[model samples]
Target: MMNRRKFLQGAGALGGLMIVKPSVAFSYAANSTVQYALLGCGKRGTSVATSFAKNTQARIVALGDIFPDQLAKGKQHFDEINASLGFPAIDDKMTFHGWEAY
Candidate 1:
């Protein structure tokens, strides 16, 4: 069976990608464990980070900010999102926060 990556690569090579619009075609794959981070995790960071966390193809794995509170908030928001999407909370999947763990 043709995996998703292979299908997309094939489509791109054939110039079929443009015909379908890559973003539209790949939207469903947007949140598939693609690890992202919140550099700020303030209002703007929360928005962008949450958007990706809610995706079916992405996961927010780590967060970094001068303020520790921002990191905690980001992780909390992502946890709620993941649970609402029927997936286990982030705490169940992996460790979050702190540069030492990275």
Candidate 2:
């Protein structure tokens, strides 16, 4: 029963709303206390997670890596990042290592 013009206008408005600003997305993410258990602590994962922490008010809750050394590195990295941002260092128990970590 809807006319073509009305449908097009409604679709346009819906599309506009879908184009959310980056800040809004980050703001919502910032308030989340949801645990993020990263499966891998490799370069790609580290880079993406690092950027999110560095560029926004978001925090990393949990971290995991197959290798103990890499897990330590990730924990250290995020701990420093958190400290610089005035957030607390990640607790030792929050860092998980070994293949079973994932």
Candidate 3:
């Protein structure tokens, strides 16, 4: 029952609404710390974690991997990256290894 003209108008209105910014949004305090854990410390997981570290004011609190070597490597890599970003290095106590890691 609807013509193309009416459909296009409605679609335009909907798109306009989608582009509108929210009136209220949550924001973190300047000194607030956001701790995050990274599981499956493989190539993809490390890449994603690095992206977060590079893009946000987040701290990598924990790194987990089924393999000890992978966990170690991930921790070293994240620590180095975060250090370069003026963030603190991850503590060894927070790193987990073995298949039971999650």
Which ten contiguous residues of candidate 2 have the minimum total lDDT? 26-35
Candidate whose lDDT is highest: 3
Greater lDDT among 2 and 3 belongs to 3
Pairwise lDDT winner, candidates 1 and 3: 3
Off by over 4 Å in 1: 1-32, 91-102
For all candidates in order, the CA lDDT equals 0.66, 0.80, 0.86
Question: Model 3: per-residue lDDT, tens digit, 1-102?
Answer: 999999999999988866665432224344576889999889999999999988988888899999988988998899899889887788888888887887
Kindly state the number of residue pairs that clash in model 3: 0
Comparing 1 and 2 on TM-score, the stronger one:
2
Residue-level lDDT tens digits of model 2 in 1-102: 999999999999978767876457456544354436566889899999988888866788789988988888888888898899888888888888887885
Q: What value does the lDDT take at residue 96 in candidate 2? A: 82
Q: Which stretches of candidate 3 lie over 4 Å from their true place?
A: 1-31
- Would you estimate the TM-scores of all the predictions? 0.51, 0.63, 0.67
- Best TM-score goes to which candidate? 3
**For residues 40-85, could you state the per-residue lDDT of candidate 1 as single tens digits?**
7689878876776665477665566666777677677877787777
Clash number for each model: 5, 0, 0
RMSD value for candidate 2: 5.0
